[model samples]
Target: MGADRGRRGGRPVRVGVYVGCGALLLAGCASMPDSGGLSGVESTPRQDAQVRVFAKSPSKDASPAEIVQGFLEALTSDDPQYETAREYLTSSASQAWDPYRSTTVLAEGPNAEAVHSGTSEGTAEILYRLSGSKVATVDTQHAYAPDSGSYSRTVHLTRQKTTKEWRIDGLPQGVVMGRTDFQRNYKSVNKYYFASNVSSETGGQLETVADPVYVRKQVDPMTQMVRALLKGPTRWLDRVVGSSFPTGTELKKGVKSLSPDDRNMVTVPLNQKADHVGQGQCSKMAAQLLFTFKDLTPTGVDEVELQKSDGSQLCVLTEDQADGIASHGTAHYPDYQYFIDGKQRLVRMPSSGSDKQPEPVPGALGDGDKKLRAAAVSRDESSAAGVSTDGTSLYVGSLVSGGSLGEAVLHSQGKTADDRLTTPSWDGQGDLWVADRDPKNPRLLLLQKGAGSPLVVETPSLDGRIKAVRVAADGVRIALIVEKDGKSSLQIGRIERGTKSGEPPTVSILELRSVAPQLEEVTAMSWAGDSRLVVIGREQGGVQQMRYVQVDGSTPVGTAPSALTGVKEIAASEDERLPLVAHSQEDGIVRLSSGEQWQKVVKDGTAPVYPG
Candidate 1:
């Protein structure tokens, strides 16, 4: 249930994409090599097994040292068959290879030996020595069974008769180690050692070593002290201030005596506790820290903002978004509030008082009894469907699902649910134009301020498919896509207020090939200026492209398609010099500002555009 709710809020809204559950088919392995089903070296099964072990075991293990050598050699082999020395085991080894088998052997004596063993079904049992190079005894138990007897095994380094050499091979039920055991063994081996698997339960595995650098296997007292002071929360402030001071000792009355040069160290944290010592002490500490450049930055701010501060605008440094406020600081921690400067860098601390305001709530989108046919809003949330220029009213078209089209209404202030309009899209001036998608008699509905029974202009049969419909700023021209004969084409119409022209509005076909021969269909169309448009679509070769078209009822000057290939979305700026185009597969938004020089202004996931 939690996952379902998360999907609703965290998942992207799919306007044209459909998602569904799927299944993955697992193919069975090829039939085992048939050697007449013999039992030993002659049979394909038995030979394959022994061959696998031969591939893994080191060439020599004649002595105790050879056992460690053999173990290291086995680990170096990346291939599981070679790494496991599987062929060396008896036929019963098949049971040991199953993944369901998860178990470890922890034996402590003079040797303090520990071993981990587990298998991933028919695959292999991977193991490593957790601690104690020398072996004394081995204890093994199954992960699925606690009552199972502990298998006692011994290591016997012997020479290979066939190779006429010594090697650690053909040992039965040997112990090995895994990741979990590695951590356990590391701590047990070094009493002073502290290590943690940084891996998340569902993510990748990482290991952090404390007190000593475990990998290089080196120990440094001073470096370890600094690392602990920096990361340990409970003892952090005390350890840091203590080490920096010379012969400092705690005194009565909530104070500590320190050397003159190190006095500032204690003063910094004390100044922060102003209520206990008074504002005068806090100000003195802040001033001192600033002058010494210890922890306080020159901008009179802490590293991060205060907790629970309200009404903070989150940073969104994308090309289409608003710039950050000046004289403020940058925020890195989650849910933090800070003030930043014009360069988008941290500059000042956020106001830390009770006057913090609440995040503003948008006005409720009124939903009336009127039915909605279609709706579209501006990409930047700058305008909604059918909003008035003054932002006081809305143009709405109502049609009941599976019912006849209803009248277009211009809605104003109201709390009544029955008074709401449907299918709202606005022009540059807030004049909303909607469409009644009546399969039988489709119509273009218009709503303007102070208008009643909206001006409905009957439209041609758009077959059964309508892609998109939007209006120009002047509210006199509208652009839409209508499908006929299973093919879509761009259609433009004139929208006149209160005029029953008695005739269909003038329509024109936007032929991209005639305009730019390489173009195919128009997937997106936006007005570049008063009389120009920016269209995005694929070319005849199925390569996505962007073209600029001038629509003044005259021949247009066709600029070359965007030099940047694979353009999926082209957002024209108020100045055309910086058109932002998004590439879905490349997962980056590039600004075409330097004339064919594309700069990756925003990275992927800022706002992901679904690929077609």
Candidate 2:
């Protein structure tokens, strides 16, 4: 819903105010419309088809090379213990090998070949060249990090002499699976953790953060996910977030598994050392597991029982009880879409009933001569930011009618109009982010609401020019469309917050990783959900199209919404349930009500945008 006029006038104005050409020179960069949903559009359900997991086993009388090949194939099976795969290895080798230590995800297709290199016939050293693109790596800690390079391994084999069959005597410790198998057998799941010492207005409640990691679908996923939670956040996020499980905490000896009971309850037995933790701390720990396992199955985990090694109960928590202790900032969004109407005025589309006409947002910018090329709304919908039509000036003002349209907050330093600022994005913290594409003085800038000077963010690894930028609703990550060497690609990077004590909180960009590597050119993009993005791009020599991809550079399963023709810009909400809205050259403002087709909702609107 649009911001209520009565409340907007009462809020304090914190951003810097400027005027005319001087203000235009202060705006950072340019970005296309990252607009969201339209009203009265029916939402479509995502496909729920279960992935097929093929089973493979070692051949009884196969040669050493065939046995090795079969073992590698068996690694992709759904067997939790990998019982069938162990048959191809010797007793000692099987005991030493740990399949869960790490998973090396290789490219699609068969790029593995086994060649004998030993002098003797009975005892041979087989070198397997497992060469392919290394897309990602998943460790035992359940952290999914991007990786690239080549890989190879050698396995020692010898005939048993008694059974006259060859067996693997030496092999690597971890498992390696082809891309196709990895996609089918493994799935990504986000584990929730809380910020250290950060409390909400309700008091004693901590804010929850989602850490996405991959786990085996058929393996003991419930246990694996919990263990990952116990291991804590990855290295990159350790400095910023905290966990309920203290250091040195671990599972009790002789307790090798965890599973839900007939009553849909999971009993977690930690070492006796956890007894020192207070009841409040224990409840927080249970809250993390409850949310982590929320989507594990259709029924989901109803409750979690924490106990000591001696079976002494420490604490018990249900889904309802955990909700009271942990807080995920408002997932609910407003009920209307905001965009620039054909008349260059800010307009609102009622996101519910049959009234399809959009009403101008109440403010000076809504009816004035300040022609805007693009605009963005804050997450709270209290303020609005816009760039002039000629891309020379940037303005920040209130959404209410009586509120003042402040002097230009930023102006473009670029020589040409193409070098001006792009569309601006607001995070949950009320900070606005935008990029300056001027080839001479290209830089990323951050504006704090009600603060005077803007902070210039660092982008050390940015080799090319920034075409557009979109920040996630969580305020931790950003999506970028970068052009280098005449080719455009989609990239994602983390927004590291400056933590130096006694200084204002500043921001910097870490190294960026490519997301849609298959697309040669990315024209427009937007955040579709927490970890996924909807991009408008195409492969080399291919026509423009839109598809959904994960921020980790992995292609998700299920068919994407049907492609639209002449689509110039696209927008989507942080909530996935809302329908997607876009501007098409041929059809004007179009909405994707169902995944199969596009429906035109407005015939005259352009540069559509939604509140963050």
Best by TM-score: 2
Q: Work out how many backbone clashes candidate 1 has.
A: 24
Off by over 4 Å in 2: 1-59, 109-114, 117-134, 145-151, 195-207, 254-265, 298-302, 308-330, 352-355, 499-504, 594-596
Where does model 1 exceed 4 Å of error? Answer: 1-383, 386-425, 436-443, 449-455, 460-465, 499-520, 539-542, 552-569, 573-578, 581-591, 594-612
lDDT of 1: 0.30
Count of backbone collisions in candidate 2: 23
1-612: candidate 1 lDDT, tens digit per residue: 000000111222111101111122112223444344222121012111112111134334243333333342232222323334443333344244431122233222112122433334432232322232221121221101111123333332333345444333333343433222222221111001111111111222111111111110012222222222223212111221112111221122332221112222222111121223333332322222222221111222222111111223211122111111110011111121111112221111112212232121121211322222223333223222333322224433221123222332444342332222323445433344554433443455554421455556445433434445555443344566554464445555544333236953332212211222234466655555433456666665576566665332221333544566555444432223334444333644444443455655434311111100
Please, what is the TM-score per model? 0.28, 0.83
Candidate 2 residue lDDT tens string, 1-612: 000001111232111111112223334213423354222111111212232233345547877656655566567656667777788888998999988888887664234456656647655455554445676778767666667777666667777767877888887778876666676677888777775422242355566666778888756678788778888886655655778877877787777789889898999999877877899999999998988887556566899999987889999999888878865533536567777778887777865424577787778667756888788888778888888888878888888877778788888888888898988888766778888888888878889872367788888888798888888765667788999998999998777776578987667778688989889989888887666788999899999989998777776665787878877788887667677888898988777754447777778877777786
